[model samples]
Target: MDFRGQISAEFLLIVSFIVVIVLVFSSIAGPQSQENSIATAAREGATGAISEMSYTNVSMKPMRVTGIKITGGSNRVISISFERPVPPEYRALVINRTVESLLTVSGVKPVNSTTVRLGDRTYTVQI
Candidate 1:
């Protein structure tokens, strides 16, 4: 009886199955984990920016954030836009301290120019 050969073949088959399963699981989990990380970063950044801009300048009445948008694909650029426009002086504070810093900590590179529109005062930052 050649039971030794049969046992070896069964062991090899089980090991290969486990390897395939691990590869499949890794492929499924990789992008999902990245997406979750980006979402967390975006949410935190937006929240911090809103809080900072809320009472940034005591001279003017506290500003209200109308809305926030975070958009991007995995392993690509991420953009965070705040609905309310901030004062010129506070733009640097929001972008540099709140948004950029948070995104950088999450390993995202923010674009150089952060645009503040005229009417809505919307602030957009690309990472």
Candidate 2:
């Protein structure tokens, strides 16, 4: 083969290879970015629930949290229900709902009583 023709073929092959790599990487990255967004939103929602100091704030439009429900209620016992949707990238996305309150009024210390239900799986955390 002529040297010039060989060089042209090599250049084209390299360019095509680069394009394929970019497309593959971009496709993988797209889903990961979505997952991060959902996770961040969920974390923000949890923080809002704690900082606002009320389940009502979590439901408010200002907070951007959705589906806040009081599944059970009592003076000392309260069951707040909220679901955080998992990112689309996740095949089995988990929805977590937590119920927490101030365990001590004097110190304003939150006694974390959280119940997480992720894709029908239930877990509890106490702090």
Candidate 3:
């Protein structure tokens, strides 16, 4: 038996094992990272929409300041909640049109609903 050949084989095996471990770790982290990215995008879009939107105040003047919370989970489910001070009229419009436009999935559109639960380990994009 050539001891030199055995040593080379052992070193190669160790290196291959390390590479496999790294690959496994990365694969595990990939989906979570992707979810984070999605969250970031959602936040930015929602912020833009809210900033550009205005609701008429009691004085009948367009008011641009309001709280909008948009939460999107997996399976293309979105839940939009407005602050207590937001006007109901604008809330409906935002949920129906603006949010749907913002989160345009391939074959699905957002429907007005109150349910937010999707599944376990959901990635919630809140803004």
Candidate 4:
């Protein structure tokens, strides 16, 4: 019985197994990382928007950002909503200048309309 060919075959089998394991783990981790990144972008964008608004008017109550939704493919649509109603005119200005400026990542685009309600405002940002 010749042992040389057996050793080479066993080595190849082990290498293939390791490659498969790596691929499996990477596939599992990929979506999770993308989700985390999206969440981070939302939080950062909200924070910057709030800060910008606050800086302009010391008397104005701090605004609460309620949610952020990411849609579309390479040219992404980022929808950010605030709990408090922003004036119709200010909505476009704030999102375009303040919010969009902060979320300057290549493909992300923030929608100009803000969803609002007259109730207790929640600052919680959801991705």
Candidate 5:
């Protein structure tokens, strides 16, 4: 009996099953990986901003931070909420630098300083 066609059918079935399994796993993991990258970038940016503050201002910033990604609006922006609000020395500059660094690490090319609107209020940020 010739079995070539039967074997080819079985092989294709197995391959299709494997591809579907891989796709399902990747879909589950993709968003999680992006979130991790965002968190790392936020930490690095905040740390770099704080380090530079050392030269010009002698104050401390909160070590614990919660960075939330904000989307689904007319504009997309990142929301960085510290355990406490930012300290009051050259505050805007620090924020701008942190924003810039955050975008840079997350695979975005350098962007010029621009204004970001959160609700009715708009603030300048450097990306």
Candidate 6:
């Protein structure tokens, strides 16, 4: 047996092992990072909605609010809801995971019952 060849093989094994470990950890962290990002988006959207709602009050005149859908107005208050479709594999990780947040002129608040399913495995936000 050549000592030089054995040393090279051992080094390669160590490097491969490290790479495998890194890949596994990264895969686990990747989904967590994505979840955090989605949560942030939901919060921001809600705040924007509430801001628009507030403007309806400050306009001094009675603005005919026609539709239930909130529209951007002069007011900074807004309520926003967001939904993300989970992948088959991710569904197992987080079955029907939902997040809801409210934004008011005063501040932001997280409210219960923000996410709902319109159809099978499909989710939406209603504020």
Which candidate ranks first by lDDT, i.e. highest?
5
List the pairs of residues colliding in candidate 3.
Answer: none
Per-model lDDT: 0.54, 0.39, 0.46, 0.56, 0.58, 0.39
lDDT of 5 by residue, 70-127 (tens): 4434444556665566667545765676666556543444444544332332333422
Score every model by TM-score.
0.58, 0.42, 0.52, 0.58, 0.62, 0.47
TM-score of predicted model 2? 0.42
Q: Give the TM-score of candidate 1.
A: 0.58
Question: What lDDT score is found at residue 34 in candidate 1?
Answer: 52
Query: Per model, how many backbone clashes are there?
Result: 1, 0, 0, 0, 0, 11
Candidate RMSDs in Å, in order, are 7.7, 16.3, 5.9, 8.7, 5.8, 16.0
Model 6: ten consecutive residues of lowest lDDT: 90-99
When 2 and 4 are scored with lDDT, the better candidate is: 4
- For lDDT, candidate 1 versus 3, the one ahead is 1
- Candidate 3 is scored at a TM of 0.52
RMSD (Cα, Å) of model 6? 16.0
Candidate 3 lDDT by residue in tens digits, 1-127: 6587888899999999999999999988976565454444444444445555643234433334233343344544434343434455555544434344434422223333312222233322222
Per-residue C-alpha lDDT of model 6 across residues 1-127, encoded as one tens digit per residue: 6587888899999999999999999989975564344445545544444344445446422222122232222222223322432223422212122233322211223433443221122223433
Better of 4 and 5 by TM-score: 5
Ranking of predictions according to lDDT = 5, 4, 1, 3, 6, 2
Model 3 clash count equals: 0
Candidate 5 Cα outliers beyond 4 Å, as residue runs: 59-63, 66-75, 110-127
Residues 9-116, candidate 1, lDDT per residue (tens digit)?
Answer: 999999999999999999999756755654455557656665766655456545444443444322233454555556676666655554454455434444444532
What value does the lDDT take at residue 17 in candidate 6?
100
lDDT of 6 at 100: 32
**lDDT for predicted candidate 3 compared with the true structure:** 0.46
